[model samples]
Target: MKELAHLNKYFFKYKFYLFWGIVFTLISNLFGIVPAQVVRHALEMVKANIALYFLFENSSLQVSSYKIITFSIAVFGVLILAMAILKGIFLFAVRQTLIVMSRHIEYDLKNEIYAHYQTLPLSFYKKNSTGDLMARISEDVSKVRMYIGPSLMYLINMVILVFLVLSYMFSVNARLTWFVLIPMPILSLSIFLVSSIINKKSEKIQKSLSNLSTFVQEAFSGIRIIKSFAKEEKFVETFTKESENYRKESLSLTKVDALFSPAISFLIGLSTVICVYVGGQEIIAGKITAGNITEFIMYVFMLTWPLTALGWTSGQIQRAAASQKRINEFLKIRTDIISSENKNQDLQGKISFQNVSFTYPDTGIKALKNISFDIKEGESIAIIGSTGSGKSTIANLLFRMYDADEGKILFDDTDIKALNISNFRNQLAYVPQDVFLFSETIRNNIKFGINGVADSEIYESAKKAEIYNNIMDFEEGFDTKIGERGITLSGGQKQRISIARAIIRNPKILVLDDCLSAVDTNTENAILNNLREIMKDKTTFLISHRVSNARLADKIIVLDDGKIVEQGTHEELLATAGMYRDLYEKQSYSETVPS
Candidate 1:
């Protein structure tokens, strides 16, 4: 219950729905006890009429047995029949209100969690797996729905039913009520023991299920690699182990859940037994009527229904509590990156990094060290580096994927940190080294981030990225579905689609982090030539290893060992006869001697 307190805001948000559900639950339970009382009165009235007739034997004023029986039947029909229908109607209403509210909350929660995921730093995503996050949103949220909706409704119904029945029993015969309630303490203790075990097992089951989900997601995502490596058997075995663990945990929970009903039923049976004995004795001693004992028995039976349901309801609560704990932990995570509270200053794309340094949080290895550079608006700068030389890291910093650990990065002389992150990011377009295109149509993929951009703009951007002709070659043109992760498209096609996606955004700065490596040199040259016109009025940073790509930039910077070692025009770097010169000579010589 404490774990579920985080839902208070949503509960209040939809309090009107909850209020009606609770009211209906109460009404249904109220009507639920009327049938038992009606049965009791019918029996008492029939007995009373028989006694009256016997006392007035041979008299014309004697009550008729047929009239008394028919009248009792009428009372039975009116009270019991009508109440049963009313109870069912209200019960249906209860479900409609509460269950609907739970769905609304679940919908809201999913959106909220997704929005939070977006706000989280890139490091958080690196630490967590996609499957684990998916589990939280899908499975964990359903568990929470159980707690808030049907479980809660039934719990309230049980309380109201128990209260009305207990009060009526005491009113009819206090001593009998006392005797019958003797089993309560034992019942409570058993529920407590079983609930504790249930809580622990439920948590394990949820965690095992998450692990299973993670395994499946990873296996599918890496299926090509697994087939190439011939490790399908290994993955299958691992999956089998995870599945076994999940089954064990679920069975453990089921075993405890199995104990609840029988334990509760056995305990409740004791109350019924006590009611019959005490009630029968009271009737025999003439302290109470037979009708009173019959009514008490019926009330005990009424109590049995909720008590039996209590077993299942308790298990549901324990499982939901476990789920709520997991959900709460995920929601409570504070994003490492917080945008500025104040409105951000306008950016003109005058980018500068003053002695910037950064290290990845998990590895603690400096990806960029004491890096300093500045690029004026509309200048095309190229970065050339070997693998792990911080070329992509520079692009990441510019996009605010991860902030620099030391010194400052600025846009238009305004500190990047002082600018609103959304606005700052909106001013930049980045095409990362690893391309990711969603399983959408080519048109939608190109027009993803930029809304209201016409098909004409999409076509123009596609042409600029040198993918328009390839798209037109497809049977469906822009409407074709690319399958999961664009698996149907070639690597070069996917990269070009990603470039087209960025080109349409029309940002103040563009960062191409090895986005053209999949394409042949000729295609890369054609795309770069088109990009030159688009980037004429925007700051462009080209991160590539190819000298052919770097030579096109107005200025080129060489990086080695996470530091900028050389910076100048490509000719100036070649004249220095250093690292850049060696790279150029190797590329140029390779080109001349190539097959």
Candidate 2:
């Protein structure tokens, strides 16, 4: 009942169409029973007075029995035809309306689900699988749509059909009707027991399908890696296992579903057999007319279908309920980007960190801790650290991917927690170490986040990043499709395009998070030179392992294990003989020398 009420609200928009469709279906069913009743009445009338009317001596006959029989035949024929036509029309109307409504439900679910994705934190993506989310929006949502459309109509039809047939059956023969009700209780019990098992099995199958989807998604995403390592057979073996599991689960479901209707039909047939045996005995004793028995049989046959369908509808209800539970669970996850009735301050990017600490939620290892720092507006600061020395964690904190537990991240000495996070992040842009590009044209990728950038501004930013000339050399230039993950671009080209994306944003706080790692030494130097002068008045945090990049900053902070251990300019840091200087010597000694 709760599920039905929930479904009613969910499908309320299409209820009017469904209501009219059901009305037409009911009318058709009402007329559809006329022929059997007419047959019983005609038989009884013909028996008593056929000879009197035929002899032409019964002047008292208001209407001839022959005329009555002929008229009944014509009326029955037209009524049967009208029933068929109305049934077809109602079926068509229901189908059309449900199709349209299903599309609307699917469209809204996909869009809203994805919109939820956009608001969820980075940790949410880390914890969940993209393929699972895709399957929910595509396959699971489709299951819900099926329930709203055909399954729902079938359910309603069964109810109306049962009510009509049962009412007629009870009116004609109360004892036989009571006997029929016996099988109904058994049928309901069977449905209840089997449906619980079916629901559990179906949910397991859906989860297994989600796992298979995850496997396929991962395989495609890492195709190049798999091929390079010659692990095609391993992946194929894994996929085969998942596919076999899926097939077995689906076949198990087929077994459950296939048994339902046949079992229902058997029980219903048993009831009818009992009814005929009892009613036949009564008719022989002259307890009821032949017409009542005839009409009763017709009603019994009609009632069988609705009883049988109860078993089928049980299966559908379980499947739909399982699907609804999955969707509801997804919707329950709270988004990390908070939007509440409470207000927050606007930001001006005078960033300060006080005793900040962060640990990955799953791993429980501190990625950053006691990381105290301050950056005045327009100050060019550099973070020099080894690979795992929490350089990127700084950038992540600034972006508010994971909020700190022990400290305050402030902008203009105001806690960022009190600010609108989206509005706060809008003033900053990051050029990450590993660049990610969409499968789109180079121009679109450059102008991605900032869509309002002019063509000239795009070209200027591209030139500054040292990739403009290379782009122009291509046949289609910036308009050429970058292929999957910008595969068409060389590593250095991809990096430079990423830099151009950051540059075009013209952010108040620009983070160069090892942005030069992919580029050649010459290209890196040129791009940094241009960027340093252009962003002189904008606060910049340069993060890198190489001394050359850090040497350009006004102040350099060297870190080890989430805490800064040294702070100085390039010469001062080298003179100090700290971890940064040692790392610099190792990297510097490996540089090229002209032969």
Candidate 3:
């Protein structure tokens, strides 16, 4: 219940619905109690007529007695039927308000979680799995809905019905009322003992289900790799283990749920037996009539469903509390990156890394050590480094995917952190080393970021990436749908399509991080030739290992062991005989010697 306290705001948000629902529940229960009283009067009327018939035997009064009894019984029957009909009408109204309100809350809650997910930093995703996130928003939310909807509705109806029936019984005879209620405290004690066990088990069950969901998601995503390695049987064995664990947890909960109905029915049956025995004793003592005994019995039976629902509703609330606790965990996570309120700055792409230093938070490895560089607007600089030399870290800092720990990064001589994050990112386009494309058509993939883009722009961008002829060869061409993460396309095609996507943005600054690695040398040269023309007036950072690419840049910076070992024009670096000249000589020798 403490965990479920988070939903108080939603309850207040739809207070009108809650108000109407309670009103309907009260009216319906009131009408529901009327039928028992109607039955009592009808039975009493028949019993009195029987005595009158015996008294007026063999006389003309007997015929009149029969006529009166028949007409009165018929009226009582109609009255009971009317009460039942009214009760049903209000019950429908109860569902319309309370049940409908739960659905609205569910919608708002899911949207709120998804919107929060969009604001969190990349490091948060590294800490959580995709399936766990999906489970929280989908499965956990559904359990909470059950508590808000059917469980809540039944709880209100049960409470109202019990109150109305008990009040009427006490008004008629307090002694019989007390006897009928003997089993209630015992039933409550049973629920109290069982509810604690239910809360603990329900938490374990939700966690196991989350684990199962994560396993299935990863297995399906990597099915191709499994099949290629001929490890299908291994995967099947692991899946079976996860599935069996889930089934065992579920069975434990089901065993507890199975106890609720029988225990409730037995307790309610005991109440009925007590009512009959006590009412008989009272009738024999001439303290109450047979019809009064009948009325008391009906009242006991009227409380049967509500008592039964008590145990079930208790279990539901415990389960809901467990689930809501899971949801609150993610909702409580605060992102480190907060966007600036000022979004009016326009960037001219003059970038500077002023003695910047950074360390990877997850790995605790220093990726950059007092690195400093500058690039004026309209200049192309290539960052040349071997693997693990921190080439991509520069690009990440420029995009503000992360902030530098030690020094300032400036754009147009202003601190990048002070600028509006969204507005600052709008002027930059980045093509990562590992390309990712959506399961969409080529044209839509190319035009993903910017809206209202013309078809000609898509065609021109594809041509600049040197994938235009290959697309034309396909049957659907630009309309062709690429499968998940562009798996349907070859590696080179996927890379080129990503390049086309970045090109269509026409950003003021472009960072191509080894994006042309897959294509052949000829296609790479052709794309680079097109990029040189496009980058004539725009700032570009070409991050690559190949000397061929670096030799064409206006400036080249060579990195080694998390520090810049050299920085100059290709000709000047060659004159210095530093790391850059050594890399160029090795690459040149390898190319000249045949493979």
Candidate 4:
């Protein structure tokens, strides 16, 4: 009930339409009662005329009096036809108003969910899969829409119908109404029991579906790796197993859902049998007219549809509750990263790690331990380390992707935690090792970091990153659409384009995390030369294992086992005859002796 109440805010947002929709539904239901009453009155009139004919069987005048019956029938016929037309009109209004409102509400809710996703921190995404989030947004949200729209509309109509029909039934024969209603309590109990089971089963079914979606998404995303490894059969078997589980869970829910309608129908059938038996005895006892019993039977049949629909509506409500719970689980989680209430302050190029130590969530090992370094404005520093030596972790901290587990990081001699996250990040640009490009034109990818950039700026940035010539070689040049993840371009081209994207912003601080590893040595040297010119007025952190690249920085830092072991100029490190010098010699030997 609490979940349902929370959902009503969406319905109430379009109260104008909902108000008119309810009014129209009430009018339509009122029209429905008229036709049944007209039929009863017409039957009563016929019974009386037949009796009069029998009393005066020999008189022609008596037979002439029956002509008035023809006019009476015609009047009732016209009333029924008019009522049917009015009912149709009101029904159309109800659908247009209420049903259309649901569609609008669905649009708003989808946007809200997506907007919330954009605000979530990287750690949230790390713990959740794309498929599970997609299922919640698309599949689960759609189920909630069903509950708000057709199910609620029909449920409200049923309530109105039962009330009006029951009132008339009691007016005609109170005793008979009591007998026919014997099954109502039992029907309600059955629906309540079955609906709870359906709710639980629906949750399991949604979860299984999310798992299946995740598997398919991962398979498609990693198709290249799977095909290269020749694991097609293995993947196919795994997908088949997941598909079977989804089917099994769905069928289990269906089994319980199918019981609702028939169980309600069986109870309704019993009410009909009792109505006919008791009402007939009343007629014979002269306690009621034949028309009264006839009307009572008709009302019982009129009650049949809403009673059965009640069962289905109950299941819909329960399924929506389960879906809401699933969606709220993610929506309710507060991100680990949030901005301080302090006023927005622009970051300068100066950066400092004051005894910073950090560990990733759910992992016991520290990625960075007591790391203290100062990077001055407009200076270039190279962070050299082997894999898992916390090189990227340093870049991540500068980018504010994660805060230090202990100690503080400063921007321009002020604690970075005091600045708004958006304003803090606005001063920096990053080119990560794993470059990702959208399936868009080359021009769009280059300009993705900033809004309202000019074509000349884009071209100049591409030229500086040494990718302009390669881009121009294509028939459409910058206008050509790159396939997913820039698959149409070579690794070297993708990395250079990514570089161009970063440089286009002309940030105060730049962090390049081994982004040049994919390019050839000659291209790497050319790009590095261009980068030095661009780095003249900006603070830069160059993360790489290539000594040739590190040699260009003013200062070099060597990391081993999450600790800084060496820090000096490139020449000073070599003079120490330490880890930096040994790594440089080994890399030089590998390059000279390579296949």
**Candidate that scores best on lDDT:** 3
What TM-score does each of the candidates earn? 0.96, 0.90, 0.95, 0.96
Candidate 3 residues lying further than 4 Å off, grouped into runs, are: 54-64, 285-287
Candidate 3 lands at a TM-score of 0.95
lDDT of 4 by residue, 1-595 (tens): 5665656777778999889988998899999887888988998998878787667777986677577677788999999999999999999999999889888888887888898898887778878999999999999889888888888899889988888888888887789899999999988888888988999898998999999999999998788889999999999999999999999998998899889778877887898889889989988888887777777777777778887778778888888888888888887887767767654776667888889899888566799989998889888999999999999989888877888999899888888777788877877889998899999999999999588999999999999889999999999999999988897899889999999999998999999999999999889989999998999889999999888889879899999889999999998999998999999999999889958
**CA lDDT scores, all candidates in order:** 0.87, 0.79, 0.90, 0.88
Give candidate 2's error at residue 340 in angstroms: 7.6
What are the per-residue Cα lDDT tens digits for candidate 3 across 1-595? 8898989999999999999999999999988888888888999899978899878988989988888998899999898899999999999999999999999999989999999998787778877898899999999999999999999999999988887888878887789889888888988998988898899999999998899899989988777789999999998899899889889988998898888889988988898899889999988988888888888878777787877888888999999999999999998998877655555588888999999999988889899999999999989999999998999999889988888899989889888888888888888988999999999999999998799999999999999999999999999999999988887888899999999999999998999999988998899989989988878878999999888888668999998877999999999999997899999999899989988
Order the numbered candidates by lDDT, best leading: 3, 4, 1, 2
Off by over 4 Å in 2: 1-9, 12-28, 31-71, 285-294, 336-347, 593-595
Q: Extract clashing residue pairs from model 2.
A: none
lDDT of 1 by residue, 230-261 (tens): 99999999999999999989988888888977
How well does model 2 score by local distance difference test?
Answer: 0.79
Best of the two (2, 3) by lDDT: 3
Cα RMSD of predicted structure 2 = 3.4
